[model samples]
Target: MPDHQYLLTLKHILDGLGRKGGLEDNLNGLLATMARELGYVRCFLAITDTEDEDLKLSLSYSPSKADSVSYAPGRGVVGQVFENGETVVVQRISDNPNFLNLAFGRTEEEMARLSFICTPIVSHSRGKPEVVGVLSADLVMLPKDELEGHRSFLEAVASAIAHQVAILQEELAVQKHLLNQGMAGLPEAQPPKNFVASSKAMRLVLRQARQVSPSRATVLLRGESGTGKELLAEAIHAGSPRAERPLIKLNCAALPAELVESELFGHQKGAFTGAYQNKRGLFEVAHQGTLFLDEIGELSLDAQAKVLRAIQEKEITRVGGEMPIAVDVRLICATHQPLEDRIAQGKFREDLYYRINVFPVFIPSLRERREDILPLAEFFLEEFSSEYDKHIRRISTPAIELLSMYHWPGNVRELQNCVERAVLVCEEEVIRTYHLPPTLQTAESSSTEISLSFGEAVGKFEQELLVDALKKSRGNMLQAARDLRVSYRIVNYKVKKYGIDVKRFVNSKSRKR
Candidate 1:
């Protein structure tokens, strides 16, 4: 009877795929049917992300909201199936050490009594079978032989859905290519001015931002400090229909707790001791525009309640006045810390979290997107050089290597500052290794062997010293020699060896006159 039921379930899923509706809809319906007929309480179909190759939860038969959860190759049982192109059957989920419950977050009590089975969804379109995804389901614990039979049944189901998965992959690949081409070919994609997205990780983030930009949905930019959350917020607002309206920004952590309410909502005369005149808050000032709240996790609980009210009601009340003022503002929030942890600690409101997380975009860290480092460095170098009236042309190859190897803890903001400083200290057309901060010289920070040789290091230091002395002496080699307590011949030799132009400094001084 069990074998007959398994055969019937497979026939139903294959037949349903032939019915009307889109590919995704048919696949979802197939999953639901499998779960119901196979006596499983939950089922999930994870498809491979075309870009990162991670297993992304595509469809499920559970009630939980679809999250941004993904599993790298060989991360868990589901990942293992996708990684090795094999099937996994856990007679008891709790006893399997490799079972990492990253998705669905089943409780330990429930896991103790459940059996899990996962099989790769293999497509044979290209002559050979290729694993395109994984089909996983959780069922009540049964006898060992029964669990094995269920695993074999799931493998058949995976085989049946392989054709639909192949078509889905092709459609997705075409859509992704078109989206990237559209972004690359159009100027509208560059609304976030001066933003550099050279890495695949960053490009993925840009795609997400573009998809959500045209709507009124609230956007939550989650990442570490200095990762350019404000720039992303600008991109979203600039792409939205609210581009012409004012884009108001406020850092929740920058202001004191006492002034947060006044800053967010407006205050009337005598609202507080210093509230001498009527002040329009950010919400009111951003009417029909976009309001970006940075470091939202730092907001006080009381302030959180008021902010939630403003978001939920689409209006705000003056601190001293009772009448509510209506405002039509799109909100974009950013936070370095995780709001879920904050909620667990009673620091953030769960309700507000849901309201703001309508569209969450995770910006990868600088170290994670190292491919973008050189482009961003060149950008900042050009910007700072023009600002400071320097003629720095390019960064040396050794300098580029150092920049790529070091881990940027402060993220893009830190990298920008680093490039700016290097430009300030650079005396010639090319920025060299010594121009970077000392922190980057350390092996641990650079994550490699010492980049500069002993003689190369000495030469860089000597060159920098020569440039400083020459600047003070106004191109007088004799005076520069005196400043360094060295002979004029030695100074001239060092200057010539480093290709330092003394007449440029003289011309610069003459121009200053």
Candidate 2:
């Protein structure tokens, strides 16, 4: 190949890497481009297995062969290049005794006529260079004079591949670190307060939280019970400028209607039967800070009127006191009940609802963001493992499937309790399905017993079958269709109808690579 052609081939490979696809797809494209441009009869890309210290063939390109192969360190020319972190070139395979012919299994006569070049894909990490993989190709039709040029070209290609791999490795490392931090209850800018926001719904919630955090906006967090509204409120306070100040929390539903005003607006000395001294209310304590009022919908009508007056005036009069004391407080309110319905029933004041609902943030339930289930489970597992003094490493695959399939009606709080219980009952390093609550197991069985029309049942079965097939085929629709003994068109139509994201079935490791 000419110098210009070599440059073009390198450019093509780099361009493919920039495209939206997994590492394996880009690598296969690179191999095919090399073969088409340089006339290589066979090409192989192998990376070292860190655990086993062996070479595993990750990709292979050949016109007549589809076999995947591996090599032990120093077993063949490919292994030798990787082991030595240097390039190897054999002008004629017959002349080089080191050529093992392990990859292609070419006969001795065929091998004698072939020219081979193998180069180490080396990367610099922490100011030290390390061989990450081997890139090798065989030239069966090129002249001897072109052998040196091709060897240099292969070395250049190896350098490009090494650069791409290093970038991907760095990204994977960052993801692993972030996941660890989340599981360990560390804060991150993207998700906020160790919350898992992998699903689009949760991410939108995070974005809103971040946007509203810097201001003094009164945020009303709306979500079902156990949807982590308190966590979200804390996240907002933590992100706010007044984060250093105290964040006073009160549950209106937990307090009696008679004491609500005293709990919120403070009490003068001898103001009530239980009051022996002057007592500061949450509003006064949270001055220049934040006050998180949970179950706001449960506030009594008189309490609501007083709360509304305090919010509007930015001042509160102590219970049984005539004078009002000024306060500067950021308010965050949460309620699972619909305040509008409460207003219709004349249980809640509309004015107070609008006052607290100025900046509403709706947190989706766990069942709504199903994609986040596994991450949240892992996070809870880590927390519970530490709490129980156990060395739980992971959740078993069957347990994961069970957790994912179940509808979490009680949301994150429920998940946290379930994981804690599992950790207490678990005996081994892994959390198995048996360790989970009986309710989870019964959930799956209950799902199957639901009443449905024949058409609905068949559609459900078809969707499940297609999903299983796609998972088995690693998101390859054509392969999934073939596995199901159906036409590709039908499979594609059903995939769209069922709103499936085929890419989700693809191996996440492949994308990270």
Candidate 3:
């Protein structure tokens, strides 16, 4: 407490505040000041992790290795403070539940916990305080009574660190925003627009896609629903050597069991009640090209045997026909259902599974490729903007953050739909949080599905979509009309039907000029 000593401590505190590196790097000098001021073994600062959702070491201090310490939060006294979210003051280590009288490791101590305490770090986000991290420390260096003072000082210091961390996060979010803008600015791919994918996992899938696209070998694409299995099929057929040849696709699961055979292999005239003509099957039309069978797992056993024969022999027998018809076509199939499990259940054929699964590729779900979320969102913005003919720019920072945290159970497909909906409904120069679908606006608070009467849900959906077009049109009843894929008169009619307050969303020109 002497003037000269206090002056030196003040000098170090000022220096510690400006150090720009890890939490420990900035706090080390302060810990030294605390040690010198209190005549104790060490002073430490600990930060909790946003990950373990528990306090982990952000920084610490001690007599010998105070400059470098390691103790995972929830491990000892430090961990106890984190787990309980309370301060500790154990003058004797042997007497307390938290006491590890036999301390070994970094603390490696017979050192008593004369006084230890911790506090949560609540940081500011958008002017709102959030507990982004936690703070803790040991007052092994301070007087027993000033434990209260140490607590106060720790609280202030944690707040300061929290503020800095919040500011850094905001800046990062902004930089990411600009980077995404750059990515979105790239020219669109040639055709089949908006199949958004950019990540190591997806990149590898594209690799396999390229390899199988050129050959007549059967390709089986597998993944949970919404992982873009159909997109892969389309890409394969579009890029194959048979690009000029017809590429036919059929959804086996969507057809009735009685209709699947005629649907895939075609039928002779009057083969069945609905079969009035000699229709050409996918295999025949896709000769020298590709045939994609989606939800192939749903094929009946009889259908499976025929499909297997077609794949094996490169020929097909029309329904009610005796002779086989030769065809050369690449086969690509996909299913969300587990084929192995189905095979075990006798719902799928084991032999047929091996044929189409010759070159198997699994598309990872969205959560696994989280890094691609924003990228995909931005891609959809441009795609939908062009489709809707809106000269839109970007999405707001808050909206983008909301998107990043969203759990897209429906994967990229869901994201595409959300963004397209946002684009069509957004009236602002840049898409704001409000432009996002109700599912997103409500997602932050609840994970439950949005339920409504079928009619009500459809009405709400139609309203948001039309509102987006009105925004893009800038009140030019004509432009808004074109953007919605409806005639000007029809748009005007729906504008009334949806009860959109057109005046509220029109751009300046639409409003005044």
Candidate 4:
């Protein structure tokens, strides 16, 4: 038997779970609502890791206070409830030996004075109820006799959470099945193909992408055109929890201004002149997945406003519809255009810029990460060779030098096109400089005294000197530094500064042996 306040809190949580948002949002809402209403000092939800079956702290009211704690099944009170699928109530947490108190960082005195309650969150699996997680709370002032009542109330909340999880899981399964069946207009939710990141700069970018992938953080990728911003977005999606769902991509600059809103937020039947039937928007299609917007700086101010609202509210209103539809999407935006300049010129909304800029990943241009150029070129050569049915065994040294010397203005995409063209033109076993585009040859010759500041010129010279030293020493940093007459520390600093990956040279030297 639950009290009036407990029932009201349970109802609020159950109702909040139905509104459109991410599972994390709904779970946080439940925790916050319950904590506020029940006077809980702390509340936490721990879900069993799919791979390891260990209890992972998924959500907490005081997130910073919650450490990255994990528990084996039946290890702690929370774990016991999850493993045994039972309710646990400790009148005083310190008296219970099973209470590990791993996350809260509470003192023994504080633990002894507080009451603890944990409930198992169970969901149906193959028509059988299975425990999926544990919901636990800390109460500072609740009487010992009231522990049973609080336990019952928490059981209700856990049930509500389990129900939501079941719904989301079912939806995800259906979406995956539909995608596998090759549903029309839906992008395949395939993992991103392996991308090369041999350069330190590119590796750092990949690290950042991996770090932010697990969380539902809005990522803004800033880079020059053809720098693989879209590729990085796909990698983020592949590494995310929503990898099984659709990853819808749209080039904002490619769409006409009149259709931007309609494309993003679908219109109802007869909503406009061309509204032939009710259609789902990209947001809806990308639910539980990712929406990658390339050239986002091209969005109109009106469109930016609408997008901002959708991001803020996790809901969207169709172009002509008044009702708001819930959307659960991880937004990954990319742009070659300078958003700050657009904001200064009133072409982009400042608020929207700030919102999307939560996790900004700057991808270095090909010129900046020159060490990756040869690897990327080789990769492209192999890919194009396979595609064109050519047995181009290797790129000639002269051709490699030419590829390295020419400043790739169009970056990776330009390099890929160049390699494809070279593959198509070359008739022999190897690709030579002659097989390369005439523009590259002319560009290399004409750019002898390339316009560069004194510092840039010195840096380039240092990088070239370091590369030559590393080559002479067969990628031995200590030997290279000794050959260059510099300390190992200085050489190491210079290598990192130039975004050089010494491992590639080291492996090359090893392969020679």
Deviation in angstroms for 385 in model 4?
1.2
Error of 1 at 130 (Å): 13
Q: Per-prediction TM-score, please?
A: 0.56, 0.54, 0.50, 0.52
Best by lDDT: 1
**What lDDT tens digits, residue by residue, belong to model 4 across residues 331-402?**
999999899999999899999999999999999899899878898888888888888888777786657877
Model 3 worst lDDT run, 10 consecutive residues: 182-191
What C-alpha lDDT values do all the predictions have?
0.85, 0.80, 0.68, 0.81
Checking candidate 1 for backbone clashes, the offending pairs are none
Model 3 spans with C-alpha error above 4 angstroms = 1-193, 443-513
Highest TM-score: give the candidate number: 1
User: What is the Cα-based lDDT of residue 159 in candidate 3?
Assistant: 62
- Residues 362-441 of candidate 1 have per-residue lDDT tens digits of 99999999988999998898899889999877787768888999889999999999998898888766788888999887
Poorest 10 consecutive residues by lDDT, candidate 1:
183-192
TM-score of 2: 0.54
